[model samples]
Target: MSTVVDYTTFAVGCLLALAGLISLLAGWAPTWLRHVERPRLFGAWALCLGTFCVTQLPALRTEVIKLGDPAIDACVVLLLISAAALLLGLRRPRRQ
Candidate 1:
């Protein structure tokens, strides 16, 4: 059924969002807090979050008819802004 499909898609989106958040946090945390040294971690997080946003597209298009497109657009915009900020912060030169 459509309801079941919607729920499944939403669940997948939630998992992707959670994974992205965890990656972002791990990458942003101070060196003392994070154990891994993956240099592209933040970029990976951004990619994951972007994929999450893409997965939600169908539900935003068909299921949420009353709310219109603004909500989804807002979410995408916010994700983009957050990703940009993260990248900028990471790129800032370290002050000695």
Candidate 2:
């Protein structure tokens, strides 16, 4: 049952990864995504999220998430990366 759930999560993560790839390549987003000022960074964040999901699987989690250092788990790293990307993406460049 847990394996089945992991596979399902993996599928969703893959889809998110694909979307991130497209967004990164396009370097632009539809008007509906107006908030994504830096599409590439946003895409990077999405990719990180996808990876995080994949790392949650029990088999992978043992290798990816070191319980010894809870602060250094795969999910935590991904979250930090995504947060940085989001912050940088949202902030506008200052006018020279």
Candidate 3:
């Protein structure tokens, strides 16, 4: 039962992280997305997902699951990276 919940959370976290990456790539590939707004939006999503993963860290660590810890940590790192990229994008001028 508990194991199932933990696995579910881990799976959700992975999905969120993947979505964040896709959002980031989409933002990067479009001329319209070159503006600050898109990146900021994506970054916010990433940050939220990251925070969610971080919040689950304790439970994940305590669980019997072997891979949860590393997976959650990776999600956190990816979110932070995405957030940083968003911040940097916002600092630059939008393409005309």
Candidate 4:
């Protein structure tokens, strides 16, 4: 299989990777997120889905081309959910 991910997939992959890194860092080091009880779990999900997107981008494209929607849908929906988790977690106040 070709190593090249097409432009759209590459763009999504890059975004996912950035989101994952930010989520993981925020969950681990940022003082504000420390108060969020489960930031790390969101981080894990984001990182995992992001890594999956990046690594499997080629196959993902293939799945799309083949009209196998579930694989592609899962990647996008799961990542969005995880990203939302990180965002919501960031909005919480630290424990007193």
Q: Rank the candidates by lDDT, best first.
A: 2, 4, 3, 1
The estimated TM-scores of all candidates read: 0.40, 0.66, 0.40, 0.43
Alpha carbon lDDT at 34, candidate 4:
49
The residue ranges of model 1 lying beyond 4 angstroms of the native Cα positions read 28-72, 76-96
- Which has the higher lDDT value, candidate number 1 or candidate number 2? 2
Model 4: lowest-lDDT 10 consecutive positions: 28-37
Q: Which has the better lDDT: candidate 3, or candidate 4?
A: 4
Q: lDDT tens digits, residues 34-73, model 2?
A: 6778889988887888777767767777765455566346
The local lDDT score (0 to 100) that residue 94 gets in candidate 4 is 48
Candidate 2 vs. true structure, TM-score = 0.66
Mind giving the per-residue lDDT tens digits that candidate 4 earns over 15-84? 7667667867875534554445565655665565665566466655576657767766766776677667
Most TM-score-accurate candidate: 2
List clashing residue pairs in candidate 1.
none
Model 1 / residue 34 / CA error / Å: 19
lDDT of every model, 2 decimals: 0.56, 0.76, 0.60, 0.62
Q: TM-score of predicted model 1?
A: 0.40
Q: On residues 1-96, what C-alpha lDDT tens digit does candidate 3 reach at each position?
A: 876776677677767666666666665333565455555466456645754664474565555255676765765675676566666656465499
